[model samples]
Every structure is written in C-alpha cells, then in structure tokens.
Target: MRQAMYGLVLYVFLMLPPVANLAESVMTIHMHMQMPLFVIAGMLMTPFLKQQFPRFFAKWNSNGVPGIILFMIVVIYWMIPRTMDEALTIQAIEIFKFISLPFLAGVPLRDSWKKIRLVGKNIIFVTLSVICGFMAWLYIFSPEQLCNNYLIVEQITLGWAFLFLALSIMIYFVQQFFVDRSECE
Candidate 1:
C-alpha cells in the first residue's frame, strides 16, 4: 500500500508540467529517463496490482515470458524516433505512453522476471544491448533529424548515450561471466 502510494506520487510528479517539460526537452532524458520512470513507477506498484488481479496474471502470463515479451514490445515501440515525436505531439499517444509504460510494461515485467531463467534474462539483456547499439549508430550517423522535436545535435547526444548504455551492458555481462567461471573453478 505504501509503495503503491509512492508510485502514485512519482507518477504525479513526473506528470507535472515543469518536470515533464524539462525531461522532454532533452532527447536522451526523454527516452531514457522519463520513459523508464513510468516503468519504474509501475514496477513499484506491482505488488498492489498483483494482489488485485491474481487470476488475470495466472491465466494470461503464467510462465512470465508473455508478459516480458509484451514489456519488451512496448519498450521497443517507444524507442522509435517517430513514436517519441508522436508522444510529444499527439495527446492520445502521450496518454498511451503514460499508461502503457507502467501498467502494460512495468507491472508485467516485474511479475515475469522472477519466472524467467538465467539464460532468458541474459537473452533479454543481449537484445537490449543490440537495440542500444543500433539506435546509437543510427543517431550518430544520420545527417537529418530523426525526431522533429529535437535538433540534430540532440540526436547525436542521444546516440552517444545509447552507445554508452550498450557498452555498459556488455561490460557488466563480461564481468559476470568471468566471475561465474572463476567460482566454478
């Protein structure tokens, strides 16, 4: 209950014009921070949601893969430059961004994560890293602005951000692999 309230508060704060405007002003912040914050808020609210709709999850996302897949789809959709532009311009899309990130992606992800095996988790991480790398390459190399709301420079910055993220993920996985191998010896 307390966590859910906190999540609600976070959702409200993020929705506030000044904060929203600030986050949306930067291409990287808009995609990486503001968008994920919605997912995090939903993550925080998962316990309450799970309690409220136990049967629904059991029936639809029994193994968790479906839920994670759905979450991934939502995330991948938002990563598109056009989708980000639509979020800024279309009220309906913006609203969907708010609702879908948390409820559709976040909640399900939290529930599904526990059910996923180590290999599955790694697969997800690898996929995300590839996505980041691809986005980075596109952003950095493209001469034209992919998102109308942002400048080309901002797009480049976002590209750098994506590159950094991909590298970080790769580093973490490599470190984990080494540690696991050492432990087995």
Candidate 2:
C-alpha cells in the first residue's frame, strides 16, 4: 500500500507539465530515462493492482505468457521513433503512453517475472537485446533524421545509448551462465 502510494506520487510527478516538458526536451531522456521511470512506477504499484484484481490476472495471464506478450507489445510500440513523435504531437497518444507504460508494461512485467521460467526470461532478454541492437544500427547509420522533434545528432546519441544498452543486456545474459542464482538464493 505504501509502495502503491509512492508509485501514484511518482506517476503524478512525472505528469506535471514542467517536469514532462523538461524530460521530453531531450530525445534520449524522453525515450530512455523518463519512459523507464513510468514503467518502474507501474511495477511499484503492481502489488496493489494484483490484490484488487487477482481473478483478472489469474484468468488472463495464467502462465504469465500473456502478460509478457502484452509487456513486449507495449515496449515495442514505444521503441518506434514515429510512435514517440506521435505521442508528443497527439494528446491521445501521450495519454496512452502514460497508461500503457505503467499498467500494460510495468505491472505485467512485475507480475510475470516470477511466474516465467528461466528459458522464457532468456528469450525475452535476447529478443529485446537484438531489437535494441537493430534500432541502434538503424539510428546510427540512417542518413536522415528518424524523429521530427529531435536532431540527427540526438538520434545518433540515442543510437549510441541503445548500443550500450544492447551490450549491457548481452553482458548480463552471459554473466548469468556463470553465476548460480540458486546458490545465491
């Protein structure tokens, strides 16, 4: 309950006009930092949401695959540069970004993480890493700017960031093979 309240607070704080504007001012911040925070807020509130809608979760996401799919869909949608532009220019899309990131992406991620097996987790990480790598390559090599709101330099910077992200995820995936999580537990 306390965590839920904090999440709610974070949700509200991020929605504030000044805060939103500042965060969105930089393309990298908008895509990487601000967006992830929204997901985190939703994850923080998962306990309360699950408590209130236990049956819904159980019925709809029995094996966590459905929730994980939903999470992936939301994540992939946001990864598109056009979608980010649409979110900025269109009020409805922006609203959807807020709602989907937290409720669809964040909540499901938290709920599905424990229910999913290691193989499923590995698949998700690999898929996301590959996607990130592709996006990085696209952003870095494309001759024209992908996003209308941001400059080519910002796009390249974001591409480098995504490249780093891909590398980090790969590193984590490789490290997992060496570390016995069961022993740590």
In terms of lDDT, which candidate is strongest?
2
**lDDT by residue for model 1 (139-184), tens:** 9999998998999999999999999999998888777776866676
- Which residue pairs in candidate 2 collide? none
Lowest lDDT 10-mer window, candidate 1? 176-185
Q: Which candidate tops TM-score?
A: 2
Segments in model 2 whose C-alpha atoms lie over 4 Å from true places = none
Global lDDT of each candidate: 0.92, 0.95
RMSD of each: 2.5, 0.8
Error of 1 at 138 (Å): 0.6
Q: Please give the distance, in angstroms, between residue 35's alpha carbon in candidate 2 and its true position after superposition.
A: 0.8
lDDT of 2 at 133: 100
- CA displacement after TM-score superposition, residue 109 of candidate 2 (Å): 0.8
